[model samples]
Target: MEIKEHIIQGVRIAELHSDNMLLGSVEEAVDLLGNMYYNQADAMVLYTEHIADAFFDLKTKVAGEILQKFSNYRMKLAIVGDFKQVSSKSLQDFIRESNKGRLIYFAETLEEALAQLVR
Candidate 1:
């Protein structure tokens, strides 16, 4: 697992990269958010290209766990990249509704994701 911080539009966002499933449960998601918060990040952009391949079947459950975890902490999360390749319609709907509320967004581009986070 690797984490890097980057500032976009004056908002600090952390990018997390993992070769394996790093967020298998709500507890792990909460811990990740806690770390980002402590690191002064306004949001997080998860790069899941590699991990997705390993845990393709757990995407929905993982996404739900992450959303639930961040909702509890009131933290923002943005998943950046081409989700069309891995996301199902159900997951897409979940993403859309989650974005409509607040704190969670699934973006095709990092720039768009950052824009949402800074708002």
Candidate 2:
């Protein structure tokens, strides 16, 4: 995993570039955020390629559980990539609802994701 840290709008964002799946459960979310905190990053940004499929599968409940963990920690999370690839209406709705929030965002590109997170 290659973590690139950036300061945007006074927030420290850790962007992860990983060839393998990094998050799959609430436990993993904790571990991941622990790494971010160790790096002095306030938030995390993950690309679609780095995320596991379970995160997008509403039936798995991984998305809600993990995102809730992030919310509990008061840390921001952003998924940047091609969201159009997901065909589930429920998942799309979930993404849409999440985008309305300040903490979690689903964006098509890293730039747009950063923009939402910085705001």
Candidate 3:
């Protein structure tokens, strides 16, 4: 994985880029968090395509576990994706609720994700 740094208003945000699934389990999520924390990142932007498909399935609890770690660390996260194409109402609702807060957001573009992260 490659992390591209973005500093906005003195906040350091790490934008993750990967060719493979970067978050497949809780352990991987924690590992990612550790890496970001080590880099002194206040927030992160990730593309949905780089995350495991199971993360979008509410039954898997992957999203909850991963997001909770970010919340615990007071680190913001923004996921860039075409969420409108998702068929699961539960996942859609989850994304909707997440977007209503400052800690996490589901955005459609890199600009949108960065904007949300800086907010």
For each candidate in turn, the TM-score is 0.75, 0.95, 0.96
Which regions of candidate 1 are displaced past 4 Å? 50-62
Q: Which tens-of-lDDT digit does each residue in 1-119 have in candidate 3? A: 89999999898999999888888788998899999999999999989889998889999898999899889989899999998899999998999999999899999998998888887
Measured on C-alpha atoms, candidate 1 has an lDDT of: 0.72
Cα lDDT, all candidates: 0.72, 0.88, 0.91
In candidate 2 the C-alpha lDDT for residue 99 amounts to 96
Clashing pairs in 2: none
Q: Between the candidate structures 2 and 3, which one is better when assessed by lDDT?
A: 3
Model 1: clashing residue pairs? Answer: none
lDDT by residue (tens digit), candidate 2, 44-108: 89987777788888899988899988999888988988888778999999999999998999999
**Cα error, candidate 3, residue 4 (Å):** 0.6
TM-score of candidate 2 on Cα atoms, chains taken together: 0.95
Q: Could you give candidate 1's per-residue lDDT for residues 4-118 as a string of tens digits?
A: 7778778888878877766656667777877888888888887556334422354456656556778888778877767777556765666678678669887888778778787
Query: For residue 35, what is the lDDT in candidate 1?
Result: 85
List the candidate 3 regions with Cα displacement exceeding 4 Å: none
Which has the higher TM-score value, candidate number 1 or candidate number 2? 2
Candidate 2: where are CA atoms >4 Å away? none
